[model samples]
Target: MEKVFKVLIFTDLDGSLLHRDTFKFDEIKDYLKLLISKGIFIIPCTSKTEREILEFNHELGLNLPFICENGAAISGLELLNIDLPKELILSREKDDLLNIFKNKVPINLQNKCKWVFEMDKKKQSLVFGLEDKKLKMALNRKYTIPFIFEGTKNDRNELSRIIKKDNLYLQEGGRVINLTDRVSKAKALRIFVRFFKKNNKNVKTIAVGDNYNDLDMLKTTDFPCLVFNDKFTLDEIPIDNLITTNKPSPEGWADVIKMALVKIDKN
Candidate 1:
C-alpha cells in the first residue's frame, strides 16, 4: 500500500461531537463529511452502543468505523483494510460483567446503582436524554451495562476500587456510568492503530473527547482535542498540545478538529 499521511479521528459523541442535550451535529455535518471525503477517518470512540453508533453513521451517510461500548468492541474495520475483520470483540459479554457486579459489589453499593436496562422505556429515555429509535438503539448494549450511580462521592470512590479488584471497571460518560470489563477507549485505539499500521506506515491520530471516559484516549493521540465541557476541569487530564474550543459541541467539535488538522499539517 502507498504510504501517505493518514489521520484517524477518534472522537466521543455526547459532549464532544454531538450536542450534549439534543444529540445533533447539523452545524458540523458538512465539515465532518468533507473530512471524510478528503480521506480522513472520523472514528467515533464513544461509550455508546453499536446500534446507536450505526444510527450516527447512517445520519452522516458514511460507513465509518467506530469504537463502541467504551471500547468493548471495534466495528467496521473492514473499511480500513480488506483483510481486517468487520468487527473485533475486545471485551467480555455484558452479562458476564453484570454477573460479576451482582455477586461481588456490596449490596449497598449495588443498590445505589440504577441500571438503565431495568428501567421502563420512559425512564430510560429520560436518563439517557434520548427518545424513540435513538433510545432503543442506545439500549442495545452487548458488552457493557449503563446505569446511574446514585451514591455519594466517597461511596462512588469505594465502588470504583472494589470493581477494579474483579477486573471490572466503570466508564463515566457525559450522561451515565457504564460497567464493563477492563476495557477502555485507549486499549481499543491501540488495537486499531496496530491493525491499521500493518500496511499503512504513515498514521497520525487525533483524538477528541469531553469526559472522563475519553481521557486516556486523548493522551494516546498525536493531537488531543477537548470540546468545551465546563463540568470537567482540564488540569486533571493535562497533556501537551491539547487543543480546546470555547464553544460547545456540534460547533466546538469542528473547531477543535480544524485546529488539530492545522497542527497536523504543520508537523
Candidate 2:
C-alpha cells in the first residue's frame, strides 16, 4: 500500500491570509482552526518579522512553527520533533547586511532608498497600514530591511544590480521593497521540506501568496496557490495546476486551501 502524504501548507500573511488593508482574517478563522484540528499543518512562511508572526500566532492561541524574515530563520521546529533544532538561523544578521549595503552600494542609490524605521510614527503607519503595537512588531526584524524606493525605474534596477553583486536582494512588494540576504521564502521552504521528508517520506506542499516576492515560494510547492490581489496579476506565472480564487483574502485563502485539499484527495 502506498503511504499517505502529509500535507503542509506554507502561506504568506499579508494580502493572502490577512486582508491587505485591514490585516484581519475573521472570515477564515474558524476554517483555519478546523484544518488545524484535522492534523494538517499551516505554517506561516512570510516576509514578516519574528515578532509579527509571533503576534499572529498569539491571536490564534497556537505556538505554530514558522519561517520568518522571508526565510531568514525558522522557529518552533523542535515542536515537531525533539531531535530537531528549536530555532534555525539561515541568513546574515540585518546589521551586517546593511553594513555591506553601505560599503558597496553607491551614495546616489542609497539616497533614493527611504528607510521606513527612521520615519515618524504617522508616516510608518501610513506606509505599512499598521499602527501602534502592530507597527512596532513589524519593525522588529532581524534579517531584512524595509524601505520605500523614491527613485526612477532605472535607479531601482541599478540598485538591484548592485545588491545582487553583493549577495543580497531587493524584494519588491506592494508599497515597500525589502533588502534581504540570499535567503528567501522558497529557500526556507525547501529546507523545511527536506527536514520534514526525513520521517514522513511522502509529503505534499501547498504554498499561498499574492505578491511578486511570493512567486518563488509558490513555485517551490507541490500545489501553488494564488489569492486575489488587485495589485498583483498572474499573467507571468507558468505553474501547472496553480490554484487561484477571485475572492480576496482571507476568504481567498480558505477558497484555495479547500481546492488544494480536494485535489490532494483526488490524486
Maximum-TM-score candidate: 2
Candidate 2: tens digits of C-alpha lDDT, residues 1-267: 765778999999999999999989988989999998998999999989899998999888888899998899998877777778888899999999999999999998899999998899999999989888999998898899999999999999889998898899998876689999998999999998888877788898999999899999988899999999998787866878899999998999999999999999888
lDDT of 2 at 251: 94
Q: Report lDDT per candidate.
A: 0.91, 0.91
- List candidate 2 segments past 4 Å from native: none
Overlapping backbone residue pairs in candidate 1 total: 0
lDDT, candidate 1, 86-178, per-residue tens:
999989999888998889888989999999999998999899988898888898889989899999999999999998998998888877888
* Model 2 C-alpha lDDT versus the unseen true structure: 0.91
- Tell how far residue 87 is off in model 1, in angstroms: 1.0
Against the hidden true structure, what lDDT does model 1 obtain? Answer: 0.91
TM-score per candidate, chains pooled: 0.96, 0.97
Minimum summed lDDT over a 10-residue window in model 1 is located at 232-241
Which residue pairs show collisions in model 1? none
**In model 2, what are the clashing residue pairs, if there are any?**
none
